[model samples]
Target: MINAKNLTKRFGKVDALKGLNLHVKKGSIQGLIGPNGAGKSTTIKILSTLVIANSGDVTINDIPLKRGVSVRSMIGVVPETPRLHENKSARSELRFHAKLYGMSQKEAKSRISDLLYAVQLEDAADRPIRGYSTGMKKRVALALALLHEPEILLLDEPMSGLDPVIRKQFKEIILDLKEMGKTILVSDHDLYTVEELCDSVTIIQDGKTVVEDTIESLRHETGSIAIELRVSDDSTMDGLESKLTSLDCVTDVSQKRGWVIVKVRDSKTDIPVVIHTASNHTDILEAKQTKITLEDIFLKFAGGHHG
Candidate 1:
C-alpha cells in the first residue's frame, strides 16, 4: 500500500538517505530497522509527508505524493516521541485531532470514545496528558493516531518506553489493525519485537538499503547459525573449540562463561557434527542449537560491509 523509490535526503553535507527503497504490502506490517543516523526516521517523515525528500518518488494506495493529491487523510502517524498538549485531557486532545480532519462534532465524539477504549484509556480519558506516565502517554498517542481511522499506519518506535505489559498490549492492537487490513510500517530497535510483529523487514545502514526480506529468508541468505555447548570442565573448553573449528561447516568459535559458542554455516546440517566432536573432547552438559536472530543480521549488515 506504500512505495518509496530512490529516496535520497541530505542536510548540509550529511546524507540521511541515499537511494533508499521501501515497499509495504496491503494488510502487512513491515519493519524498518537501522542503527542511529541510518535514515529510518527520515524515511518515515517522508512517507508521512512531514519532510520532503530531495529526490524520491512515493505513493500511498496508488496516490502519488504531489500537490492537491491529499494523502494525510489516508495515513495515521505515531511518532517516536509523541507531542500532546500537556493541559488538555486525552478526550479533548483526540477530539481536537478528529476535528482537524474535518470530522463533525457527533462523529468526532464517537471516534474519540471508541479510540480511548481501544487504547485502554477510557478510565483516564479525562486526565490531563502531562500527568500521564510514559506508557499512558504512548496509549494516548496511539488513540490520537487512530482518531481518523486512516488506511495506513506509520509507527516510529511505538514501543519505545512502554513496559512489558503495555508493550504486549500495544502489539495486540497492531495485530488487530492488521487483521482489519491496515497497512503498517513500524520502525524500532528491538529486533525481537520486530521479528514477532512484522511480516517482513527492511534493513538499512549508512543511508542505504542493505537488505529487505522476510526474517527467515534473511537468516537463510546470511547463513548465520549458532550452537551453544556447555562443557563439564573449563579446561577442556579450548580442546572442544579446536575440535569444532576443524569441521568445514564451522565458521568461527568462541568461549563465554564456561560455554563454547560456535558459529556454523548451517545449523541444520552441522549441529550434529558439532555435538559429536564436542562429545569426544569433554562431557557434554548441554548442546542446543540457537536460531539466528534479527539483531545478529542487523549487526552483520550495519556493523560492517557485508552483502
Candidate 2:
C-alpha cells in the first residue's frame, strides 16, 4: 500500500538518504531499521509528507505524493518523540486533531472515546498529557494519530526508551492495528522488537538500502548456523573443537563458558553428527541449535554499528 523509489535527501553536504527504495504490502507491518544517520527517520518523514525528498517518487494506495496531492489524509504518523500539547488533556488533544480532520462533534466524540479505550487511556484521558509517563504519552500520540482512522500508519521508534512492560503493551497495540488491516511502516532501533512485531524488515546503512526481507528469509539466505553443545565439564571440551572442526560440514568451532559452539554448514544434518561426535568424549548436558537472532543479522549488515 506504500511505495517509494529512488528516494534521496540531503542536508548541506551530508546525504541522509541515497536512492532508497521501500515497499510495504497492504495489511503488513514493515520495519525500517538502521544506525544513527542511516536515514530511517528521513524515510518516514518523506512517506508522511512531513519533509519532501530531494529526488524520488512515492505513492500511498496508488495516489502519488506530489505538490498539491494530499496523502496526509491517508496516513497516520506517530513520531519517535511525539510532540503533544503538554497542558492539554488526552481527550482534548485527540478532539483537536479530529476537528482538524473535519469530523463532526458527535463522530469525533465517539471516535475519541473508542480510541482512548483502545489505547487503555480511558481513565486518564481527562488528565493533562504533561503528567503522563513516556509510555502513556506514546499511547496518547497513537490515539491522536488514529483519530482520523488513516489507512497507513508510520511509527518511528514507537518503542524506544520504553520499559519491558510498556513495550509489551505498545506491541500489542500495533498488533491490534495490523489486525484491523492498517498498512504500517515502523522504524525502530530495537532489533528484537522489530523482529517480533514486523512481518518484513528493511535494513539501511550509510544512507543506502542494504537488505529487505522477512527475518527468517534473511537468516536462511545468510546461511550460517551455530550449534551449541554444553558438556558436563570443561575438560570434556578439550579436543572436541578440533574433532568437530575436522568434520566436513563444520566451518568453525569455539568454547565459551564450558559450552562448545560449532558453526556448521547445515544444521539439519550437521547437528546430529556433532551430537554423535560429542557423545563419544563427554556426557551431553545440553545440545541444541543456536538460533540466529535479529541482532546478529543487523551486525552483519550494519557492521556492528549500534548507533
Candidate 3:
C-alpha cells in the first residue's frame, strides 16, 4: 500500500535518505530496521507527510503522496514520543482526537472505551495524563492515533522503555492488529520482535537500503551458510576442513569448540554432502543445523556500512 522510487531526503549537507526505494504490499506487516541515525524516522516523516522530501516520488494507497492526498484520514501514526496534554484526562484527549476525525460524541465515546480496553488502560482513562506513567501515556497516544481506524499504521519504535510484561502485551496488540489486516510499517531496535512479527523487511544503513527481503530469503542471500559436522576425534578435522573447502558451495571451513564449522555460499540443505563426506571419512557423532536471523543480517549489513 506504499511505494517509493529513488526517494531522497537531505538536511544541510548530510543525506537522510539516498535514493531509497521501498514497496510495501497490502495486508502485510513490513518492518524497517536499522541502527541509530540510519534515517528511519526521516523516512517515516516523509511518508506521514510531516516532512517533505527533496527528490523522488511516493504513493500511498494509489494516490501520489506529494499531491496532498488526505493521507491523514487513511493512516495511523504512533510516534516515538507521546505528546499528550498534561492536565487533560486521557479519555478527553482521545475524544478530542476523534472529533478531529469528525467523530460524533457517541462514536467518540465508543472508540475511547474500545481503545482504553485495547491498550489495557481502562482504569487510567479517567485520570489526568499528567499523573500517568510513561507506558500509560503512550497507550493513550496510540489510542489517539487509532481513533479513526485508519488503513495503514506507522509505528516508530513502538515498544520503548517498558518492562518485559508490558512489552509482551504490546507485541500481542501489534500481532492482533496484523490479524485485523492493517498494513503496518514498524521500525524497531528489537530484532527478536521484528523477526517474530515481520513478514518482510528492509534494512537501511547510512541512509541506503543494504538488504531487503523476507526473513528467510535474506538469511540465505547475505552470508556464508553453514552446518555443523561433529566428530569425536581431532585427528581427522584437517581432512574434513580440506574436503569441505573443496566442495563447490563451501567457501570456508573451521573447527571450533570440537565441532566442525563449515561455511558455504548456499543453504544448509545442500551442506549434507559435506556432512556425508566427513561421515564417510571418519567416525561421526551428531550434527546440528541453524538458520541465520534478522539480527545476523543486520550485523552483517548495517553494522559494517554504518561503522
Candidate 4:
C-alpha cells in the first residue's frame, strides 16, 4: 500500500526522477525495474523517506508521506549496499537496532532471535560482521529491517552480487514475507528475480514510468511469443528467412548464433505455419516455442536495445 504521484527529484542540473509515478498494492511484491541511470534507486529512496522528492505526493499505508516519522514506522528499507558496524557481531547489530526501535528487553530478545533464525544466521549470530560474506551481510541487513516488524519492505538491489544459492535463499525469504502479509517494493536490475518474485512490475525509463502491469498482461500486450528454429544447412538460411518473413502472422524475424528467432503474434497458431515455411527451404534442425521474458519487455518499453 504505497503510492507516489508525479515524483520529481533533482541533484544540481540532473533530474533523477522526472514525473515518475508508482503504485504498490497491499500485501504484494511489486518490482521497480529500469536501466542503470533510469532512477530505480532514487525512487526507492523517496519511498523510504531517505530522500525527499523535489515535487510529489507519496503515501504509505494510507498515511501521508509528509509524516515521515509515521511512514518510516510502517516500512523497512534495505539499500543496495547494506551498511553495518564491522566490529559488531550479527546478534549485537540486530540487538542494537532493536534498542533503536524502542523494543523492550524481553520483546527485543525474542524478536531478534526470530529474525536471526529467519535470515538463517542463527549459527553465525556471534560472528563479527567484518568477516561475513556479501550474502551474509545482506541477510543481516534483512534481519535488521525485520527487527521492528514493519508492515512493508523497500528492498533496493537485494539480490545483486549474490551467488545462486544465496539468491535462492533470499527469494524464499521474500516469499515468506509475502505470506506474512508484508507489502514489498523491490528495485532491481535482475529481471529473472523480478519475474520470479514480483506480482506486478513498473518499467521506468528516463525517470518516467513507461509501463506498469502484471507479467502476463504485459506479455500478451506486446505479442512477443516466439518460434525459434535452426536450419540444418547454412546455405539455406537466407531462403528460410525470406519465406518466414512473408508469413502475415510473423511480426518480426531475427537471427542469433545459428538459430532463426521469429516473433509471432500467436505461437499456438503460428508455430506450425512457420515450421512448414522453413521446411520448404531447408531441413529443420531444431524448433521450439519460447515465452517472452522480462528482458524482452525491458528492451521493448525502456528502449535500451543498444545500451
Clashes (N, CA, C under 3 Å) per candidate: 0, 0, 0, 0
Please provide, for model 1 over 47-87, each residue's C-alpha lDDT reduced to its tens digit, 9 standing for 90 to 100: 98888899989989988997666799999999878899999
Residue-wise lDDT of candidate 4 within 1-307, one digit each (tens)? 9899999999899998999999999999999998888888889988888888999999888887874355776889888889999999999998888888888989999988888887788999999999999888988988888888899999999877778887898899999999999999998888988999998999998889999989888887766688888888887777778788888998888888888888887767887888888887789888988898988887789865322
Off by over 4 Å in 2: 235-238, 251-256, 304-307
Largest lDDT belongs to which candidate? 1
List all candidate RMSDs to the true structure: 2.3, 2.2, 2.9, 1.8
**Candidate 1 clash total?**
0
Provide the lowest-lDDT 10-residue window in model 4.
298-307
Instruction: In model 2, state the lDDT of residue 138.
Output: 85
Top candidate on TM-score is 4
Instruction: Report the C-alpha displacement of residue 15, candidate 1, in angstroms.
Output: 1.7
| Better candidate by lDDT, 1 or 4 | 1
Q: Output the better candidate (1/2) by TM-score.
A: 1
Please identify which of the two predictions, 2 or 4, would achieve the higher TM-score against the true structure. Answer: 4
* Winner on lDDT (3 vs 4): 4
Mark the 10 consecutive residues where model 2 has the least summed lDDT. Answer: 298-307
Model 3 lowest lDDT segment of ten: 263-272
